[model samples]
Target: MAGEITETGELYSPYVGLVYMFNLIVGTGALTMPKAFATAGWLVSLVLLVFLGFMSFVTTTFVMEAMAAANAQLRWKRMETHKEEDDDDDDSSTASDSDILTPDSYERAEKQPILSVQRRTSPNLFEITDRVEMGQMASMFFNKVGVNLFYFCIIIYLYGDLAIYASAVPFSLMQVTCSTTDNDSCGVETDAKYNDTDLCWGPLRRVDAYHIYLAIFTLLLGPFTFFDVQKTKYLQILTSLMRWIAFAIMIVLALVRIGKGHGEGHPPLADPSGLRNLLGVCVYSFMCQHSLPSLVTPVSSKRYLTRLVFLDYVLILAFYGLLSFTAIFCFRGDSLMDMYTLNFARCDVVGLAAVRLFLGLFPVFTISTNFPIIAVTLRNNWKTLFHREGGTYPWVVDRVVFPTITLVPPVLVAFCTHDLESLVGITGAYAGTGIQFVIPAFLVYHCRKDTQVTFGYGTVNKHRSPFHHTFWVGFVLLWAFSCFFFVTANIVLSETKL
Candidate 1:
């Protein structure tokens, strides 16, 4: 089956696409950022976040440029296929979906998409209308081993994202419902690192309550993986609205506390000890490269596409700075929670049951919506990876087994531990790095070479990145490796620090 395609005439305005991109990048990562900022020192966090955001933007362009090249190549083959089919009388012959256009695939030119798709594949390299997802591009440029590596990194990243959602929703539910009244419950004054053995309802331990909630979350969202789940336009709007309201409330409340001269944070200018976690958190917050094809393909206009993306990043950086800075200063550095919204549940910051209720359940509403979708995507990826052309699967294996595997590992992960910070940190440190920096860098570099070979050196790709140089590509790769080493060292040193 074809991947989700944003059709040509149904494209969104460039500005509208900005909102979607913004929404995509600023997800659960934002919720976990304030703690990292507070711990790392506001000044240090600010510089790191800004730099990371810029790096993510650089990679975003890299992915977009590669996408356009892919589109151009597809269009070229469609043109060639058009000529061959015209010369033959077999109008019923169709291209095999597995046939990807490359130097090797040239001999089997009959198995390429024909010019019937030309309207969707525009002549202007910048105005690529076909929905060439990242997976397709990886196959187009990379050899078998390279493609497998790409999928592995992506699968790991998706699992990390799912695990976060699985754990976060239950953890949030436990905190909110258990915090109020009921002495048998793990009540309001439980320690920051409350354990599973603590008192919950009746004979239930704190961990029992968390696991119970996780089970409930799994039952509710996990089954959606058995089928397909697409977030409708209405669902997107609602999620976006809730996000804006929750974030706006958080920033405003922090500013209010700061304005009253009640700010408690007095962080150092920089802390070498906290930089590693801070880097991971900031990298997670600025992520969007993986979802770029879905975001960029639908945009109707090409003019100022890069500028619009830069502006969106600027806005996001400002938002994160405003949110994290306000949070660090308004709340004491040491007192900040991993899930920042929980801090407002205190009597001092916010007293209204409505505000606390809304903020407290924010993750439940948002992450719940996303969990099943990611699960389904991972399940689909599994099928794609192991799939053979002209092969089929038993119904039980396709429907029951794939979803079961996808659902179990992450839920079991949440069952074992609910440390959102460690989950996000590890996820961002490794898979997140690959998605944001390494994959995009490699994809663009190899894509540039492929484009030249396929279209000849003289064919200028109009949509190539402004940072279209070998040095930029090398810089991105070096930076990715440096980050990998830093995170590895941090993990080892952290283990020793204990």
Candidate 2:
């Protein structure tokens, strides 16, 4: 299976791929969801979350199918090149013989090559053997304007992501470290609000502490963007383990608080006005579509790919429900922090000092691991956007300029405001809409047409989406438009109220 796939990474079982997808989808967005749930009311949040999860799953399948199509298109072009070379050579037979299809590790190993001159159609050609990133797919399927729009949307989305990370880590650190109460008495709830003007260390203010931590964070993680750095397998495993433990601890503590008679929350049944932010939260929470190629391409078997995706979504939805439901029942909506982990620290929910400390610092640990990775990704995208054909970048420009541009803007944004809820909402509602909804719809639609033109309508893509009809593509686009309108109206009304 490793030999069959063309990616540089090692192949893994589908189950392992599922785990990667799960970790990718559940991140800072999930941490903020409880607050969004609390504000929107439990019923509204649950309904929107389930529907958005389904919508996200539909687009995920679109991306996977488009990946298979991209692979087929690459194979088809290579086959054409091989045919052209064969025609020019007197020993064309030798050339053709050397290019014969060998048995792959997939279930279709026994099948003949779809690109053969004798047979220009085979399902094997469409098998997702190559790891094609979403940007590359945009270049393949979209025209000049479309490609530029795609890059613009994704760049904006990544900027918002970096900003969220930039603020979240420091905010968590500031809250955890600046608390004046002793460990024994920290569990008692107080009406005191720790605003920016409040003193943390003698004359130092809480806002000043946040800035100091943010600076420290940048100094530590910012350098990685200048060089190529990837999250190694072991690092991924360690961070994922920590994430699970953190989430589990929060859930259990919330349940314990609710199980006792001390539950302080009595949320409304529904709140239509909060639906806008809730939509963004849910969309952001289910954001694995952008990273699906990296996760899905190396799977050893994809015969049941759609089924596996469905199962993953179901589990994610259930887990999210459990987490948010416990939280809303255990604490007041007004008291829930943007970072849910912080709620446990200030309340009587957890009497243990170590547990509270761990919950408070959890975001700092988990987010720090991802910040460098996202920063590098955004830097590379900037280079790609401005790249010219056969042109080379100078060492200083390539190394220094790009990373600086990527890092500075987000840090400046974080400096102005650490309002993570608004940041996540706006990011997910706008740019995330393009990445999660618009691009996949167009990619699958255009890729389907291209596949039919090259391989004929008879060639079937084994990994094609369950919602393969032309109407599904239009449906996704319509939903994207509706989301835009709905979110825009919500923002306007919110401002009017203010």
Candidate 3:
């Protein structure tokens, strides 16, 4: 099956298909995962993260298979049409020559056989060529452009939400650590040696704003960047490596902060189970449902996808657990927005400087990562709207115009509110819920087949069992209702004084 050629003798690469799986998971979610755990609490958040990963894996595999089946059907239709056209052309050529038969006709036909052959072949060849070209264009538009657009929208929503929350890190840090005693009101006076540059004023605030704006701008530009996916292979590899490095650093930071007993901050005033709330927040911040889609989408070997997904989730869970425990132990009364919460609150000038530098440069990584997703969405929709091959139009409208139009509203919202909690909450309650929970459930239900059920392989489709179908239907409805409730809850929370 791997080496089999189509009737047209074209070869396909299995490797390229696998790469997409890694790309999807590692892109936007890595940056904000810590924050997710920080919001939800360890036990609940960790469980949810694991469940989310499983669901994502199942859903992605189902979708990939469904799409592959659809493409096969389309290819079959194209091939059938081509064969019919070829037969019709042969008949037409034969009929046209039948009228002039005479005693010398045999001699004339023999001498002009090459001419007749050319005549018979030319029109069919032209028709086949046209069909092939059309097929290629259609395939490119659907696979490259259409799918990419959906990805773009999902990432924009993810990154935009993350930026809002990440931008608050510096401000939140300052609130927790700054001393009011000296002329430097926003500065922290610590005995720890190192040069302290005050981030309270001057260029730092502008820097923060710059990071926030850059993040928003990147999210806006994401839909237009899909075309470059084929071109930016090396850049993507480098970025992925950088992201993994960042994740490593975050884990180390979480461990160090926790080891020093600086994890938990002030206890929650409203919840008597303050430790649990703190734990929940830390877990929520780290639990990233977004990464699951990537983990499950590409299978390098049979069963390898599932294995890797399990492994990644286990690693992620362990990281979250360690980070949360250390955080609560170390900062018992002062934990804030993320697991490395104290990096923002440390009394050492050098620590603060390092924190500021990290905070400043972090958004750049995020923006770069998110750009492709946005670009994919814009390119796909543009093709759909115009009924042409993607990137066929060479005007600003195809590139600049559409991205700008999609991005403006979100940018305005970012600027106007600039509230991290509100933004993150809204995203989690709406977009996060849909992408992580709702979509996966639907895909699983739609793709499972009856023959696969006896071996417990068909949970995704479950077509053989009406019970499974009803269960999935209810599950999807429940997810939808939850999404609506959370969205409404977020809105109310944002508006009211509760």
Candidate 4:
């Protein structure tokens, strides 16, 4: 199986792949968590985030197991077909020899060479050597409806990610540019209490300034979706560096403030109403299942894939706990901002002018690098979803329509509301729920069933989950539906009260 499928495109080491997975999972979702934590109360937020992280880890392993099974199935089928073709050629040559063959028939038989699978032993049924993307595996193992559902779920999740990126970058620009500190940092932010409705320069209100910034942002980045972009290794490194420095500063600053006996927030133990949004934010923060193939495939050694993933999740959980816990305790509940960095823009929060500038503009720099890449990703997904086996689209449909569809709806949503917490929460709870929870569960169940039927129950995949019991699949489904019901009921109840 290893020979048949060329899986040796090991471009990076296993540890590098682990870092890639960690970066992918810990993006914009982390930026929106502090506000949600303040709303839900610190104790409730901690419990919910820990549980959701565990749930997400479980589904992640399910995806890894399914990937292995898909590869094994591919290997077995290729070998079977090769054997049948060999048998056909040998039988045909024998039949011609038995009969009175013409010169033409003999020449044809001489030209034909027999390829025999008998020369090779049966493929290793447990070997996982190739990259099988989730969509391809879905089509391979799922019913028609399930395949369509998988695509739909993934598309919605990608749209949600794009929307978050779109809104966050512009909102950060608006905050940092308009609200400067009164030190070596900058001028006064007008009235310190003036809301997002305040004017920026002349007649342009902050909302209007946000719209202008959004327009400029769209013009700069949106066109990239129409064409293809290449590797962004340098961009990734810069953004990652900025991300770590900014987050570390915020956490350290908050802890120092608490030690000085100036902590203003004293949240209750738990708040049931806020739990709905907290669960969504945590699930969103832990999502990397959709991109698992690209992250896992290029590793030189995959034997320790599980260990690497487990360690990454543990670090991410600890980071989220520290960051949010510090934010909620350092600032008043009402003072927490949707974009966490805004909480530090004021000199009072962090007296250093340089630190305030860095923290305030962090989202603009980091999310800016990501926005174009995600736009292109969403555009490519559109092409794949509509692609036919032997057919092609016109240049206009291929370039314009797909990119437009990818770039517009999200920008429009962001324009309507730069409220990052609500945007992240809603998107996470619904589309994130499907991708992070329900889809992976269904994928593993179907992959396992297909493996049993094709390779018999005696065959065990090398990468099957540690919690490989059938019961885990059912539990994932049940928990996802329960969250869905609770979120829906909460939204309805809030609307009724309004």
* TM-score against native, each model: 0.90, 0.92, 0.58, 0.88
Candidates, ranked, lDDT: 2, 1, 4, 3
- By TM-score, the better pick of 2 and 4 is 2
lDDT of 2 by residue, 1-498 (tens): 243545537888888778778888988899999989999999989998998899999999999999999998898668666655655764435544544432231113223223442254666988898899999999998999999998898899999999999999998888777756545327322222557887777899889999999999999999998999888879988888999999999998888888887788888889987788888888888888889888998898888889988999999999999999998898888888888988888545677778888888999998999999999999999999999999999999999999999999999999999888888988998889889999999999998877765555556788889999989999999999999999999899889999
Candidate 2, residue 461: lDDT: 83
Off by over 4 Å in 1: 1-9, 89-123, 180-197
- In model 4, the Cα lDDT at residue 360 comes to 78
Q: Is candidate 3 or candidate 4 better by TM-score?
A: 4
* Model 1 RMSD vs true structure: 5.9
Q: List the residue pairs that clash in candidate 4.
A: none
Residue-level lDDT of model 3, residues 280-357, one tens digit each, is 232224333344323222322332433444455455546545544444344333234432432333443125565544
Model 3: residues with Cα > 4 Å off, grouped in runs:
1-40, 82-231, 260-312, 319-335, 338-360, 372-376, 379-400, 437-470
Model 3: lowest-lDDT 10 consecutive positions: 122-131
lDDT of each candidate versus the true structure: 0.81, 0.85, 0.42, 0.79
Model 1, 30-105: lDDT tens digits are 9889888877887888888988999998999999999988887787778568656653654443576323333334
What TM-score does candidate 1 reach?
Answer: 0.90
After aligning candidate 3 to the native by TM-score, how far in Å is the CA of 387 from where it should be?
Answer: 5.4
Colliding pairs, model 1: 196-207
lDDT of 2: 0.85
Model 1 poorest ten-residue lDDT run: 113-122
2 versus 4: better lDDT goes to: 2
